[model samples]
Target: MTERPEPTFDPRALVRSLPQSPGVYRMIDASGTVIYVGKARNLRRRVGSYFTRQAHNAKTQAMLAQVADVQVALTHTEAEALILENNLIKELRPRFNVLLRDDKSYPYIYLSSHQRFPRLAFHRGSRKGPGRYFGPFPSASAVRETLNHLQKVFPVRQCRDSFFENRSRPCLQYQIERCTAPCVGYISEADYARDVRHVEMFLDGDSNRVIDELVERMEAAAAALKFEEAAGLRDRIAALRRIQERQYVAGARGDVDVIACVVRESMACVQVFVIRNGTNLGNRTYFPKAPPETNSDEILYAFIAGHYLGGNAPPELIVSDDMTDREVLEEALGGDAGHRVRIRSRVRGERRRWLELAMSNAEHALSARMSTQASMDRRFEDLQERLELEAMPERMECFDISHTQGEATVASCVVFNREGPLKSDYRRFNIEGIEAGDDYAAMRQALERRYLRVKKGEAPVPDLLLIDGGRGQLAQAEAVLGELQLTDELTIAAISKGPRRRPGEEVLHIAGREDEYRLPPDAPGLHLLQQIRDEAHRFAITGHRGRRGRRRQRSSLEEIPGLGPKRRQALLKQFGGLQGVQRAGVEDLARVHGINRALAERIYETLNG
Candidate 1:
């Protein structure tokens, strides 16, 4: 193998400039655009690793060759570097990085402690101000479920602290038996405080004690002949039982948090089950990205460190695989949670059983995901063969144009990388230099503009270009690309509306073929194309409808004959729209503030007599 000459730019100079401390590092291009972001324990040595000839892969080599400048932010510790890395990646969103881009903020159940009488509420984000925040729950419905259970079992008031303090009488919550109405002094302050304590206990996993108290209350109410009150207590007890019923996977013993991970190539799945007081709160699965060469321990170590860095850390974590630095992880999480934490591999007894179950789930989930991806790959290959392309189109770009009766002309390009739709790569264009309602012209403009960047090496060149149309539209796109001298570099195809828009009967337009090919209604390859085409149509239509809506907002019926501004406004205000007026009777249109009977009758007849 021939050795490539190194750049004269001194990495030692860069390393010497960096402080020998924990920090986050950035590799930037000549334009100062960051190509990759990394965290380092020792900034100099860590950044120096990229310059080493033996330590580089094709991806990292490509990243390094593009680097023109290095940026570093010194942190207090390696842990701080990790946190800063996640934050920066989330913000900058550099290429060659995997991220949790779901945009969903974890939910929490907060019990307000600021007022004389506390109240429970569902919340997301921080624990700022005064409140007892209980989750970072997986979903809103999960928080609601726990809230329902807490309200029934603990008698906690679900209201704002301000509302609780201002109440002069029992509210509807009291009538509905959802609350004890401590806001109106229906329950004594001490008793309410006791109820809050019980809630805290329940959340803290003292389920047995909480149940004992509820049972005692029920017995006391029954002995006093307050059977109605006793019945309410019975319901509370049943609710607790119901909660237990929902948690069917509860372990026999141990407060063990079982962690399992599955890895296939660069993709990884981490499953964590939190068992507190022998009840499984729940199990959550995380798909973390790791280097292919890295073993399970390193991945698991990094995963645990990153996972518990911002969330609640369990006391005892049992993993399916061993971690490189289990003690360091335990110490780090222990400091965060203000408790002694243990991270260990599977042990004997029920803890091991939980670990096995979690591992099983991880394996199944990973297998299913990989299977789905493989099927998509097979379909993509089949699509390429059917289209008779030189190579498979792993990166397909589909173009669609949407308009409403020659108004709000817009075009959209949806890019599908090897995975399903890369929504981030989707682009929308406003058509110009073309008549409105001219979909072929609009598509030509979009493709020309899109490929102009591809020629300049500013945008990725897709393996295949897909236009939503028949031969006429495809020819328009072909001519545009041909004029730009880009037709040979790319394969273009067109998808027209299937028979009666029946998905599978789609017509595929190829460049040289006189007649378009039709895929059978039942072919898997055809179904795949239909899905992609439908998604593109849906995306374009949505974009066009949004533009149309804005245009409509700026339009008025006064533009038509016999409709003055005032009368049009009156009609719109009364009937909402032409459709509404069409559905309305003459009497209904006449009921408008400014509409007379004759004009209203005329309007109704004009719409739909």
Candidate 2:
């Protein structure tokens, strides 16, 4: 291969400007959009490597050739550089980098500590407040399912302290035996405190002990002729047993974290399984980036030091391998956690079994990623052959519109580069100018908004653009691109449903082509188009539904004057919906918190008068 030219920018000038320290560097276009991001030990040599002829791969050559500017942020050390790189790539989203697009925050189960009667809740995003958060669980439903099981196993309150205190009678949590209802005197403060202690024990990994105590209480209650309470306790105990059975039992290891690392083609994926008292609570995966030449030991060392720089800590961490400065790392982690951190290698026994489980998960994850990549490459090749393009449409973008009788119209733009779905690049638009039910106008609006960004150099102009419609939709999109003088800058096509809304039969339109083309029902190229079109449609529909849901939330009197969060919550507690609030009397309104006499009268007059 011919050597690519060095970037026209001054190398010495760049190095002189950069600190002889650790940090992340970005190669940017004249417009200041980051094309690639990297971390460096010797800021001079690492960056100089990019400008050298022999150092450039076809990909890096293309990336560097476009570099008109360089941006750098100095860090304290190489480990900090690694972390700063990951965070910047996540935020700036450079083009010529292998990115992890599904950056959605994981769900967690939180037992609120701020309230007198703390509730077990499903939470996501920041854990910036007072709570005992027990997970970075895989999904919201996963946390909810665990919360449901926890409620059954432990008779602790799941209502706010205010709601708990104001209750004249036991609520459904008490009726369902999930709560002791201390607010209504059904359970005493001391007894509720004991229940809270048991809950803490359960969360701390002493599930059997918690259940044993509950079982004993139930037996005693039955012996005292409290049959109803005893039966409820029996159900709870049974549920706890069921939950315990579901957990994977590892012999005699208490509250340990098993971590395994898998590195492939310079990308490292770390798998973590949280085990509490020998039972596997849950597992999560982290794909951390580092220097291309870095080894597993070096990567893990950085991962531990940088990952937990501000993150939560587990007392015992079981790893597949040991670190060089295990003592220093443990101490650093301990300082952050305010508890001694134990770092152990996977040895033969229960610890080894836990490590094996984590490795197995890492293997499965890598296998899935490889499969997705292979499928994507194959689909791209097939598209290239069909479209007769200069190259494979390595970066394909699909557009679709969604509406509910035109009431809540929305459009979605989804990107799939060489790897697979670039989820982070996926965007949603609220269709502003189109009339309800006008799909063509909606398509036009979406394309204009998308291409205008391209025109302004705000987004990468995709190699191909797939529209989810027929010739008419294709015409509107074509017109927009023409007006923007980018008609040939992007390859455009449309996929439309066939006669009678059939599954396989479909019509396709290409720019400047008068006749619609038909492909074999199972043609690979056609199937690829269908897949892209379907994904765009799914994305659009999901966005539309979310917007409609939020709109429904806003239209209620909950948004009316003087109805704050506390009062709105109280109204929801009494009345299920807006109609219920409307029908509620002045006295009922006054019963809600923060409503008071005047506010209640204002609400009553607004509704009834």
TM-score of each: 0.53, 0.50
lDDT of 2 at 357: 82
Query: What is candidate 2's local distance difference test score?
Result: 0.73
Candidate with top TM-score is 1
Locate the minimum summed-lDDT window of 10 residues in model 2: 98-107
lDDT of 2 by residue, 1-609 (tens): 999986677865876666677677888897778888877776877786676547555666677678898888888866567667767766776766644433345557778765566666656678889978876564443554566567656667655455556778876556545667777777666776677777777767777887788889899999999999899789878877887788757484666777888777776777878766666667766666444544667667656655554455578888877777577567667766778888888477877877998888987776666666556656776777766665456578999988889978999999987677889999998988667899988888888788776644457668788888877888898888865545544678888888887867888788887777777776677777887788898999999998898678545556468887777777877888666888898888888767787888777777666
What is the Cα-based TM-score of model 1?
0.53
How far is 434's C-alpha from truth in model 2 (Å)? 39
Clashing pairs in 2: 255-277
Error of 1 at 6 (Å): 14
